[model samples]
Target chain A: MNRDALSAGLVLLLMAVQVTFVNRLPLPGDAAPDLVLLAVVGYALARGARAGAVMGFTAGLFGDLLPPAAHEMGQYALVLCLVGFVAGRWAESRPEAGLAVALGCAALGPVVAVVVGVVFGGAEAGVVALTGGLLPVMLYNVLAAPPMVWAATRVVRGRDRSRVRSRERGARRAGRLAGGRP
Target chain B: MKDTRQARATVGLLLASALVLMTVDHRSGENSPLGPLRGAGTAVFGAVEQAGASVARPVVRFFEAVAAAPEAQRRIEELRGENERLRYALAAQALDHRRSAELHRLLGTAGLGGYEVVPAQVIARRNVPGFEEAVELDVGSADGVRPEMTVLNGDGLVGRVVQVGPSTSTAALISAPASSVGARLEGSGEIGVVRGAGENGRLLHFRLLDSATPITRGQRIVSFGSQRGVPYVAGVPIGVVERVEATPGELTRIAYARPYADLTALNVVGVVVRPPARNPRDAVLPPAGQNGAGR
Candidate 1:
């Protein structure tokens, strides 16, 4: 109904999808597509910089709970926050541009993920392992993004239109009452 | 605007929280204040996971049904191959039984003891990528799965239980980089420390007790037992000698071994609860084997 409620519901849906189906989906190796990153990027692009950053942090926190290779906890949060900020800035400037933003966000998602994973995870992990593990998942997210964004846009716009219609009806009723009294 | 300031404040707070969590996670060894919180978080996550699984069950069932058609054909082919392998294995086992009976008769005359077997099931596997060589089992403190307990599968030594929890315990496989077992060649009686090499290979660094005792490839390596106590029972098959070499001036010989146990596909295991007594006359070497070899 409201923006906050919509965002909350979206976050929960994204987290649920990530932990359940997406995590279980067998990729090339043990890696899985990061649905939470996609959701964070999409949300940030639709909202502003601040909203994106906050959502990114929250999504990252949730991602930490998802099967981690190492014990390092908050690495995901830092990386996702950066991703959100970057995506949010892009969205703010080019509000109507969707594809370019989606591509850039998707591309950055796994790079940030790998970088954070390598630095905080352990000394044993190498660049080859990180690339081999994360790259395919990134590609999947990029390919899946356009349709996802389109659907999300449709939902948001439909809600906005309904709100506008109700506001217009209320205004008309108030005007009629005022004119009738005069 | 007020909203902008509130947004900034929220981001700041989130960052601070993340920092705190990271510090706590890094520093808080085995026992931490946040341990309970983590357990609680995992439980909550597990609940969400179940709900998500419920929602996706229909799709999963459909996929399974679709996949089963091709799988049925594959299963038929697989069964045929399995039948052939089983026949070969049965023949091999018959030969093994004959040799074992001969060895048992010899050992009985020599007044040596026999071995007992304990069975267990692998319950939990470590999901960590690099640490794929380890697993946690349902058998633990209650089931006599104490720390340093040697674990064996159907074939040979898998690893030892490093850490024991109340209901679960973590076992590092023989393939792990940190694992080393004191093993001696079955035929030659050449003693060597079987250290895990990269991948599935174990490097046997032989302590040259007698220069005359030559090592050979394909020799079965068994545990020599420790001086303090035989944590691993003697005569448990460790690995087979794959390669052997000697240098002109070197004090000892070096060899490589392929462990008998399959590091992967581990479903059931056996933990040696009571290890056999060690002979005090045996010399002690460094604790070479700790974890798997792959780093």
Candidate 2:
């Protein structure tokens, strides 16, 4: 319960920073890293599938409700939820495979978001967005995933880091998966 | 890890709810039932975003300055030469009428297009990639920012106020796929609609009302404004024509133009609460080829 609360608070902060700070940066590309997605992937790797899914949902809901919302209320929530769940499965089974999963999930997120926008919103606008925004954002997220993923796991699953570092295979608890490159 | 079925159920449930919520919001259309909810969220999050923005501004500015170092270096060299020549000219003649005129234009209180504007800093930005681009401003309804008030930077039209909270409000960018503005050709006065060219936000599609009006690559476009200037104010620079599309048999000719304001890098902007008494026409526009890289 305490872990869940900590992760939730962290995600909320990530969402706030993403909207206010990250998006405002004069980055090279038109898009910024989806910090919420990165946090979700990281938290999932640390906390397992159920907690990951719930975390993703909460984070996505925050993204939906936060100000300057251009998309519909539930659009991002659905995408993040799925990313969290699959990332959790990787955590549960192959805990050492953290960085790869984070990269894969982060890359997959924008594509899913584009699909969701087309299905739930307008097809024409979705096509236009995918063509223009998808590549740069995908690349940005993937590049950012490694460091952000490591940081999230460290922040959310602090106690477990020592255990993972000591290479205690199979001694890991639920909601505390080893993250990053083995 | 062992509770696989339960975890799957939770995922399924959350995904389902999100889908339902999206569908309800989408179906509600213009007058969304979630309007109040959105407003409430804005009120709550606006304060948080403002606080966060204040804390983050210095950090962001540092990175921006670093990222722009090369350009800034080049600019410094150019300015040094210009400064040397300016000092020589100033000594030659203490009369500085041309310089004063430039300073007056830069420092004037009368905003672009003569609108009474409330200056606001962007506290948060929500960019939905190719579909939507919106930003939350620090000043809001408390600052007399009503919904539909025109938001512009010195460069040109940014967007318009959409949702106003007590201390903050959101404005969609002119580059948003959903945004379309009424625009007029600089000299011809032939009106048309300029729609956001989605995705990269590098260009806008202007469809001339009359296909035979002959809009060339170097033509300029300005806001036609709206009734009482509710959404857009008159004569604000929109963009300069970049390329005219060949629509051989179409009634309206199409051209793509680059927006004056750098939509990708927005900071301080003004929201026009009161539009000019008379249309400024081409006066608000930056002299052709100065900011207008039309051709």
Candidate achieving the largest lDDT: 2
Interface RMSD of each: 6.4, 2.3
Q: Model 2, A1-182: lDDT tens per residue?
A: 67778778878887888888888888776788888899999888887788789889898888888888767888788888988999988767776777888999889887777666556645345334566677888999999999999898887767554332225533554325455335
* Tens-place lDDT digits, model 1, residues B1-295: 6756765676777777777777787788567565555445544544455455567656654654575777778898999999999999999999899889899787774332223335765543332222223554556576766767788876777777765544455676665433567777776667767654423222323343455677777877777666433456555677777776665567666666767775544657888776433343443321223111111
Model 2: residues with Cα > 4 Å off, grouped in runs? A48-50, A89-97, A126-131, A159-182, B1-8, B26-33, B77-114, B187-191, B207-213, B246-254, B277-295
List the TM-score for candidate 2's chain B.
Answer: 0.77
Candidate 1's C-alpha runs over 4 A off are A1-6, A27-31, A66-70, A123-125, A151-182, B1-13, B47-74, B78-295
Clashes of 2: 1
Model 1 chain A lDDT-worst window of ten: A157-166
Best by DockQ: 2
Give fnat for candidates 1, 2 and onward, in order.
0.21, 0.70
Interface DockQ per candidate: 0.19, 0.52
Interface RMS deviation of candidate 1: 6.4
lDDT tens string, model 1, A1-182?
38646765676677666544554443334445556667677767666667778878876776554321124457678777878777877776676576788778877777665555446543234333344434555677788778766565445444443321134645776688799995
